[model samples]
Target chain A: MVKPIIEVFDLTAAYGDFVLLDKVTFDVRRGEVFVILGGSGCGKSTLMKHLIGLLRPAAGRILIDGGDINNASGQERADLLKKFGVMYQSGALFGSLTLEENVMLPMEEFTKLPPEARRLVARMKLSLVGLERFSGHFPSEVSGGMQKRAAIARAMALDPEVLFLDEPSAGLDPVTSAGLDELILRLNKNLGVTFVIVSHELASIYAVADRVIMLDQTKKGILAEGAPGELRDHDSNPFVHAFFHRETAEVAG
Target chain B: MDFNQKTGCLKLGARLDAGEVSALWSAVGGRVRHVDASPLETCDGAGLALIWYVQKGGATVTGLRPEIAALLRPFDHLPVDPADAPPRDNSLFGQLGRAASQIWNDTRDQVAFIGEFTVTALRCAVSPGQVRWGDMWVIAQRAGVDALIVAGMVSLLTGMIMAFQSSVPLKQFGVDIFVVNLVALAILRELGPIMTAVVLAGRSGSAFAAEIGTMKVNEEIDALVTMGIEPMRFLVVPRVLAGFLVTPVLTVYANFLGVAGGFFVMMALGFPFMALWNQLVSAVGVTDVMTGTIKSFVFGILVAGVGCLRGLQTGTGASAVGVSTTRAVVSGIFLIVLVDAVFAAIFYTIQW
Candidate 1:
């Protein structure tokens, strides 16, 4: 069996008094597109945060590659984080900097590349995301689609092995969202980078997801996990069936 | 053949899986030039990774059992790279240079902002209708009337303290009547304006910074920018005009309350009301009142300018708002004192 790239061992996420995810265990295999699907407020974003090491889990462990991420010190966790790229939902671009400078930020911090080389790499990453012309513009000056593309370019600046995206299709129109989906497929095929995405949009999920884990807010745990088509067709749970097929009766009740 | 000598060969234990690594490493001294796995029983990916790290520097392994080698074959070609270098420039000189450059940028931005504010104010002064009278009235009530009690109380206490401090020495020489002259001259000339400036800086100046800083963080400033309305004209001008129109009045009001406080002390010291009033009227001249009022008017400009500048310069985040507020109060107080000193020197030279 191929070794998984990321391992979540009985992880529980909590905020002081409220438990978000309870004893969740999962594994993301190498080179696979893994989607985390859930209704709103079901701890999807919280799980993403815990996976990216932005927030520590309340219990259990998160192992990235082969290193124990939760047990690692600051420097060790930073080294582990270099293996993964993350694009936040808001795009999280520095409002004061140009897109080119924003892409160069990670390279400047993490690599010893010279100024010209850093600029060249930044331009290349921007071009990869179809943002070559908008490199000189600030984040606020660009369209929302352009901003998200620039943010993705910034995340890919270091050529990480794993890419984690939090709701890449959120707030984007259907046409723009389809374009982003195509870009993600192209990148995944060309670069062979593993992806762990948290999303709710059914079309984007079915189009891109190799497998998905459905989280339930009321259940406070995963309701189903499998290939999206299989889960939609074969899963006996009414909630999973309703969520994937877009039926409103069982879910709304 | 014993494994201790003749090229640092490590003899593998019976169980070389993940659970036995610590004890095995302690026994093996952490550096193995060669591995002899003849006695090996079991191994996993973790055990293979451990051996790879131990033998990372071009070590040779002999006598590895075929099963153990098979277990390690999957990870045999793991990439070897050098440790990454840490980030740079944490030394004191680097920090000092960064701070100096930041201060230089701040000063330049402040100068440019002052120019912009001056142009806006002058334009509004020429076309009075450009100013929003409603906002000006609202800000005047906030920055002036609401601030009256705190300003009045501080100035009054300051006057009483000044009078009481002067009375002991004057009464010794049978000159208790002169306390009113000293209090009136000093309060009207310097203390009233300077003290009122400090109070305004603490009260309205910091409030201005906080209000605008919150707006900046909430993106309301950006919304205004997109709406094509000049924020300086719409937001800042009212505050500045309110400061200019209200500070002098506050200073004058503070001056009288201060004089009355001195009267309270003087009357307690057995000086008659008419005599104290007569001394005060004779001692405080038109020039003294004008000097204090004019100084206070300039102080108002300083407070409003610094407050607005710091607020507009705010960066993003929760801490950025706090930092802007602190910078506003600090720079407001600093510029007030510095301007007062420059005025004192100019007046001394002119014998005002």
Candidate 2:
């Protein structure tokens, strides 16, 4: 069995008086595409933020590569941060920088690579996402899908052990979104990088996810956990079944 | 990682990551002909990049690790070429030509914006019910009422400083009584209106630019246009009207506060309160106050108009709103000073 790259035990997330997630327990194994899927307002984004240490969990622990993310400090914390990369829903590329410069920013900050080597590495990362041709273009100049791809390249700049994507296919069309899924699969297969994707796109989930955990807004916990196909075909939970089958809860109920 | 200089062979280590591979390139150099990856246990993207970098330099890498080979295979066909450099115009004449063109284009845009605003203002004037009175009231409270304290404080300090400075030199010539005339003339004719206008330029002008610029960036303005709404009528007119109405009122209030400040200095200098009041009434007239009021009205239009113009002219990208805001403040102050100079010349020529 592959060792878990991330271990979450009894994680609780809340915003002040309102709790969004409660006693959420899950583990992501090394080199697999693990997805968190739920409908709107289901706390998928909240969980992703907590996993990346952007938000503090109200209760429980999150362990990334054997180190407790909450307890680590100083150099240890910086080292832990370098272990994962995040691509936000908006692509979040700096408007002033070209795509190559955006990819090189992480390397410039974290590595001791010479300028020439850094440029070459940035080009390589862009090439990985098929964005080498648009390296000189700004984020505003590219299509939404291309910007997302450039963002992925920037995320891979430091060769993080895990990559977290928030709603990667939310605004993309079927073709562009499928292309992104293919890119994600290729990167995972070739580099053996773990992917933690937060998405509700059924086609994308079935295409790339090795394992998935479905969260429920009302229950504030995982409703189902299994392969996408298994959950879609045989899950007993009404909410999980409704989600996978694209049926309203009323019909499934 | 170990590299044999004489044998032209590079040996990989158990772990190759970003931190460990930084020095790998320097050690391998260009002389590397073969890479021995049989001993390699783990490699990341950066490590793969290093290997690819060597392979692209014509070195043959031999290894039995299927996993690492899979990582390198995808990028193997990608050509190792440098990115195209951004174009630059380094010559002095090229730079001058660009600057001249930008200035000419900016002047043309400014004139066109003024024409458009004039047409909108006239249309709104014809149908007064079309104006957004609620938005105008809100802008009035924000730009005028909220600004009273700062405007009054600045006016008061200016009056006090003028009185004290003039009194010092006048006392030397036994003409200290003339200090009241000097303070009244300066505050009512110039200081009050100019100070109030400057405050509005910094406060309301920047806010207008930032608000509109953000709307432009978010495509909200485009949405308004698509909905058959003119942005100038829907947005700029209300703010401009509120500015035009409030500036003169603020200027009058600032003028009173400035005179009060001068009264304090005169009282502190042992001059009788009644004597200073009588002197001020005789020296300052309705025209003196009217000149400042008229200047404030024009300054108000310039400041608010420039802000709205900059906002509507906002470019695309993350820094667009920021750039527009900066331009609003700069252009607002510049226009105020230029128009004030014209006002000064007219007043001087007429001996007002």
What's the TM-score of each model vs. the native?
0.59, 0.95
Q: What is the C-alpha RMSD of each candidate to the true structure, in Å?
A: 10.2, 2.0
Considering only chain A, what is the TM-score of each predicted structure?
Answer: 0.97, 0.99
Q: Interface RMSDs of all predictions? A: 14.9, 1.8
lDDT of 1 by residue, A1-253 (tens): 9889999989999999899899999999999899999988999999999998889999989999989877788888788988898998988898778898998898678765555445655665676687766777778778888888998888887778899999999999999999999889877876577999999999999899999999999788899999999998899988888887888855635
User: Residue B68 lDDT in model 2?
Assistant: 79
Q: How many clashes does each candidate structure show, in the order listed?
A: 0, 0
Model 2: per-residue Cα lDDT over B1-352, one tens digit each: 7888888998888888777778876766578899998988888767887888888889989973887787678776777776565566869998999999999989999999899889999999999988999999999999999999999999999999998888999999998988989998889988898889989999999999999999999999999999999998999999899989999999999999998998899899999999998898899888898899999999899999999999998988869999999999999999888999999999999988
Q: For model 1, how does the per-residue alpha-carbon lDDT over B197-265 read when each residue is reduced to its tens digit?
A: 888888888888989999998899999999999889988999888889889999999998998899998
Query: Can you give the DockQ of every candidate in the order shown?
Result: 0.07, 0.58
Name the weakest run of 10 consecutive residues (lDDT summed) in model 1 chain A: A112-121
| Top candidate when judged by TM-score against the true structure | 2
Model 1: which residue pairs collide?
none
